[model samples]
Target chain A: MTIIPFPARSPRRYGDLVVTQPMALEDEADDVRSLAERLVAGEEAALEAVYDRWSPLVHTYALRALADPHDAEDVTQQVFVAAWRSRHTLTPSPSALPAWLIGIARHKVADVRAARARDADRLAAVVSLPGAHELHQSADEDVAEQLVVRQAVDEMPDPRRTILFLAFWEEHSHAEIAERVGLPLGTVKSHLRRGLITLHRQLEGVRHESR
Target chain B: MSHAEPDQLAGLALDPDDASEAVREHAQTCPECAALVAAFTGTRRRAGADALVAPPAHVRDRVLADVRAPAPPTAPPPVVVRERRGVPAWLAAVAAALALVAGIGLGRIGTGETPAPEASDPTPVETDDGGEVVAATALTALDSDAERGEASVTDRDDVITLRVRARDLGDEDGFHEVWLINVDGKRMVGVGILADGDDGEFKVPRHLIDDGYRIVDISVEPDDGDPTHSGVSLARGELA
Candidate 1:
């Protein structure tokens, strides 16, 4: 598994947005390439390792795109199965596996949307339909935002990461998080403040870099 | 109203209940502060959304199983040969022994009323004994639940044992059950009920762990007479 190195600097203001450097993209790409090579070689354990590393990301993308947990789960399954079946076709290089997986995910998501549209059309013949193009664009944007946030969270340091996960992912109150993690309330509050700034900065930096 | 600092805006975004009147008024009037608040709120909302969930363990299992299924004769044979060559005989034997032990342990736990023996030293300190630590993971909270824990799998003379340490798991009306779930999530073996303390150990069948039952799950099961999982998992971690 690829270990992501944390950034050294604190969050810095970039005009209206606070910004920090995101994780090393180059290292991440290399990690993906290595995993894909092992997978393509038919190493069964590689499949499990890849799933452990990327399932959360894939599941999150599907959930955001489909807006239904069941559909998201189905799409996520389809994506991995398709990727594994077509592993031979993928280039054994950095970014290939993730790109291939994401491509498969996009198709699965599109299929779900099309199916839903057809069902809606049949159910209500007179209902005005929204533009599929707009929907797809928005879904892509949402997944992109989620990816940025996930990367930011994944890159956070220990206690901060745990605290932020409890706050944002678990939606726990400050007091609840402190009690659960056995930290003082004031410390939890401080971590929350710093963590949010770091996350915001990381998100802005990713958006900026992608642009 | 004065402008709110980023931290104040973040606090407001995380919990409106924590918002002071000054922060609310500042956010209402200051566009920058409002945008900051909106950004924080958006990140928090997205994080809490179901997107962060892992796919049911079975999905990976099924996908891999399908991929590994025998292909038509026309397919290349090198892949199969490579897979066969990858496993050493010694490792395979060890894996098989672990599976057998796990199976026996499950039966003992299921039928017997006695709790699985607790290690006098709860820490995963490696002993000079033949048992070795195979894998470990820090259990993370799922579905915004506040449970936190760690789990380790040990290979003791071909028998596999699971040691778990959990915290912040407040009293549940139902009992807490530990399970070694297959990657596909379709198959699971009940290791044992979690003791009311911070640390506990359960013997796991090697087959359960070897056959893709790598996810360690601790769930709150209602005493509803049903033996199956209540689906109210408090903490889960996949073995590395």
Candidate 2:
């Protein structure tokens, strides 16, 4: 529930671009570095700290990837256990722990999918089902898309970021967001519109970069 | 609604109920507008799907129990250090020359292989007199919570080769730069950028080692166009 903040000073402008400093994300980075250090030092409590911070994302990703609650729960446990085992080999940086956990999640998800695929192939041979492959493919794509969107939102600047989270994560209406955040309804609408546009552009850029 | 402005399109994408009838009509007919709306809606839908779910308490209990359990005996026995005094002068010179070549080759090859296994099983370099002269130690995390590493310093001929394998030093915005700080803490020598792995081998300048620069420090350097250390040390270990 850390509130990410944009730098308070004047927004620095380049040619035609204005760059807002990411103070909140930077603070989160500092926190991550500290947590990673503790985990590396063989402190058992640090393991819990990491789990508390990242288990939600890990679980959500696994749920989307595996498309089963039980599988997601299993993957979540596996990811944390693997992370603990390999704590000694982790890089001491803020992004390192999250990145490492995500990496492990990706691998675990892949393994689950592979296992499911083998099962599906065997079942399909005995009793053919149409659109099975298409369904699986779309589900995988959905998980990847969700991951990208989550990352973009995580990096977004203040009001827009908070507004988007309120609207989507908290399922708040514009009026509710205004009331909760103490902003004018008009301002909330404007911010939501602008935030959506920014998120769309960021997602597009990610797609291109990955390609 | 002639052509939806970026914000208008974003609004339409976010919620059709909030949009004007005219905007909704235009989106239905205009493929471009429709695509934009679809993309926005899809992104919003997926982002919303990541609602936080607290993992079951039993899972936590299980993880804690597993982690708390004593680690299995998998690692090899620790290397024992032995000192030998009667080394022939010619053998020392030959070893130094071979080390110099190996160090240069490592640089040319670049870092790609895994460093973890090699660190645990350090290859013994034989001198002309069949004596081993490798000095190594476990590098402890400095400011980080869990970063740990190992460093091995060997004298081949007169070339001082330093090999390091560090783990859990998470990714950073800037690069991880390795340095050999003098024991006196006044002077430091820049080794090189630590690659995206746990291992790196550098040919240390003889003068640096001779001058007592034995502390290995890894600092995160911001990409702010600064070449100097940002004074943010992530991990540190002294070469024995």
Which is the leading candidate under lDDT? 1
lDDT by residue for model 1 (A1-211), tens: 1111111112222321211113121224326566777778655566666788777778888887877989988888878766666667766754455556666777888798778878775435323445656767676867756675765677577899889888888778888999998999988988887788777765565454334
Taken over the whole model, the C-alpha lDDT of each candidate is 0.64, 0.64
Compared with the true structure, the alpha-carbon lDDT of candidate 2 equals: 0.64
Candidate 1 backbone clash number: 11
Give the count of colliding residue pairs in each prediction.
11, 24
In candidate 1, stretches whose alpha carbon ends up further than 4 angstroms from where it belongs are A1-33, A40-42, A67-70, A88-100, A119-130, A147-157, A166-211, B1-47, B70-240
Task: Give the per-residue lDDT of model 2 (tens digit) for A79-165.
Answer: 898888777778776457656776687778878876876777665553376776567656755665576567657657887788889
Candidate 2 residue-wise lDDT, B24-109, digit = tens: 89989998988889988866777765545667778788877876664433421111111122435543443233223223212121
DockQ, candidate 2, comes to 0.20
TM-score of chain A of each: 0.55, 0.55
Interface DockQ of each model: 0.14, 0.20
Q: If scored against the real structure, what TM-score would every candidate get? A: 0.38, 0.40
Fraction of reference contacts reproduced per prediction? 0.34, 0.34
